[model samples]
Target: MEEYQKLSLIDPQRVANLPTPDKLFLFLSCTGSIEYPGTERAVRIVGEKLGIEFIESVDQTCCTGYMLTCNAVNPQLALASTSRNLSIPQEMGLDVGVFCNGCYGYLRELAHLLHSNPAFKEVGDKANQALGREKFHGHTKIYHVQELWFRQLEKLTSLVKRPLTGLKIAAHYGCHYLANKDVAIDDAQYPTFHEEIYKALGATPVVYKERRACCGYSVGRGFTHREETVLPHITNKMLSAATAGVQLMTTTCPGCNTALDREQKTITARGNAVSIPVIDLSQLIAFALGAPVEQLGFKANTTPVLPVLERFIK
Candidate 1:
């Protein structure tokens, strides 16, 4: 078994380029789009608030990481396929921003491989040549939306109309975002982005054990491990959050949300109950930015967060 490497992503001091780029191509994810729609809505709403030019391509296809992780496809095939998918926006010279952690990791890792390995680049080149699209010149920059928000924390702070006031939130940093610690996202050991956002919105951030533990949906769902190993880990997370008195929980990955939110009943069935609502970091941002709760799609949630609504909703 490959040991999960512990990592911490440092908070970026500034937006890579301020005043926002004119255009950003979004590589939306399946889990985020359908299971945690509020995250998508939050990204759109935050982009609007920041005056960012955002573009979406329905013609674009999946990164296929989900299937790849399940060993359903060859790694080489996954690399070549991702290279083709990434080339779409590079041809348009648009910087890429993804809301999903899986997309962020797959796209960045695949792009890095294509850029550094001549053999891999050749495979990607031949594959794209067959498609007749321009070669992916490696001109594109990839960013997770958290980078944008952290860079523009001041702007985010100014937009808060309904301060979170005394509401305690626990930050759930999924494994993928900081998997490569040298990349340094937001202090993985004492992550501040999610907590900072909660603080800026006027909520208190809570810390607890296993704050960095895997949400257990990564490679366990397809196997019985989800019932045996995964559920226990998730149960621990819930107990920690519940005991800490956190009113809400937030994460950047949809897989984490799906595991924590959709599996709440299973966790409860194991003789553990979690009262705090699980939400995406994006959903919390949308609320702070004054978006209507109904528009944010809370109904899609298996775990109702309605009680916390009165705190943020005007």
Candidate 2:
């Protein structure tokens, strides 16, 4: 149950007790940027509050991870594209910090594979060559921003703009991010930093039955099995959280947000779903940090943020 026990997903060299870089390249996943703009805006706002500078890239595109996992594309193609994205951070001389759980998982997994396996690295390198880009060398370390925030609990607590004293917040850590135990904020089996994140901002973290359950977005369940698989799975998750009196659920993955927040309408129409609102962890942090309500872009949420915002937004 220690770093040594977990498969070495994070670069061992980067594992020593080193100060987290104040400036990091924030890799905005496709969903986090366009589909759910609040995540990007809120991340920027929260970064400002933490006094951390975020560097972005116009050349960067989707992590191409969704397809990679779904087997729509070969690992070579996935690795090649991921290399180009990682290169942007490497050239800037900073580690990559991702907000989306999907991006974090794909980028980290791709980087680790390329770094440790010469054959995979060669495939990625050739793919990069075809695009007239530098070969995939896996030079930069990848991290989820949540990991940074998790380590700064005291700092976050010190900067609370509006305490969510009576709020019942549920922590949806999602699946992929935690699967990589070596890199996640805490034990993937029983993550606590998320609950801690909620508590630090003065909200009560709800402990629900499916707190550790998969949102069923990954592994092609969404497309291959929605009603038969994804819907029922997610519905049960919602059932437990709502039954526990959850007001809003916070997630690290946009995919999970789509499954848990958007699908509630479907479940509700069928007469058996909870209308619990879902938002990215960053938006919640931005809210607690007093980022302007308009800036957080809660209106983008499928489930109304007003249910929770009305409590604090004034």
Candidate 3:
């Protein structure tokens, strides 16, 4: 076995060997679908430009990892949900590519747990048995869409119809994406892969103090701790980005996109006067690759992205 594949024996779902996937079972996020459909559109657009086929299955349901993380759902049910969703891709002989960090992290973590631990394997077996379909064999590999983009960096660079020259962009890796350190592409403490991607698009990537900070909306924290925690936490993060002169912030997760994009208005309302537009990394890639602004769905964002769009896209 190759060194990377050997290292991934413990967690096969997070194999380090980056394959050029021509077709992928695109794992859809409920939050991304409802709140920011544009990100999904951007993913499709980018995929098209890259000549990759993304398969969306209606049979694939929510990963339920969100509710599981929120402590609102039973553990077995969450495992079962993950098993069912993963089975769809596995049955189709395609690896899973997720756009949201929540889906990416949860699916990988849960799948790893189900396969590695005999106790959880029992749970997965039972869950599959109950459904009366193919048992969860843990064959499907889970990957974040960003990894795929990084894998195709050369092709992506070639497809950049609108280079993001002189635009200052910052990256928010999101907590969930970094949570699985063993499977991540770069160091958790100091990642620069996204910055490298920005450079590929001819944009100046800014590294701010709080670029790696949690978006404060995970696991229902936005609702439970808005005033006491979420607001102040987000406020500080945005201020740090503003201090770094970030024109646009890109997130790997739609949940982080929602938190960072929506909370800016809240921060501004409270007199902080910080308004940095946030968008999905895929959406930004789509924009740079000549996808139309209307197709990107910037209108749904609370913080207007017109200034950033007008500055670079025109």
* Residue range with the least summed lDDT across 10 consecutive positions in model 2: 1-10
lDDT of 1 by residue, 1-314 (tens): 11122333444443345336657998888889988787898888988888877898766787767656866546777766777878888877788988878888888888888888888888888888998966776657888887777777788899987788888788888877677465645555566667666778888788766677778887584334558777887888788777767778888888888888877888887778776688888888888778888878888888888788675676
Candidate 3 lDDT over residue span 1-314, tens digit each: 00111121122243347778789899999889788999999999998888879998998888776668656446887887888888888888999989998898889988998888888778877877788868788879888888888878889999998999989888998877777887787667766778878889999888787877888886345446446678888989999988888899999988888888887887898999987889999999999999989999999999988787796666
lDDT of 2 by residue, 229-267 (tens): 677788888988888888889998888887777778878
TM-score of each: 0.91, 0.90, 0.91
Off by over 4 Å in 3: 1-16, 72-74, 219-221
Q: Rank candidates, lDDT, best first.
A: 3, 2, 1
After superposition, the stretches of candidate 1 with alpha carbons farther than 4 Å from their true spots are 1-19, 222-225
Assess the local accuracy of residue 139 in candidate 2 as a C-alpha lDDT between 0 and 100.
72
Give the Cα lDDT of each candidate. Answer: 0.77, 0.78, 0.83
Candidate 3, residue 27: Cα displacement in angstroms equals: 0.3
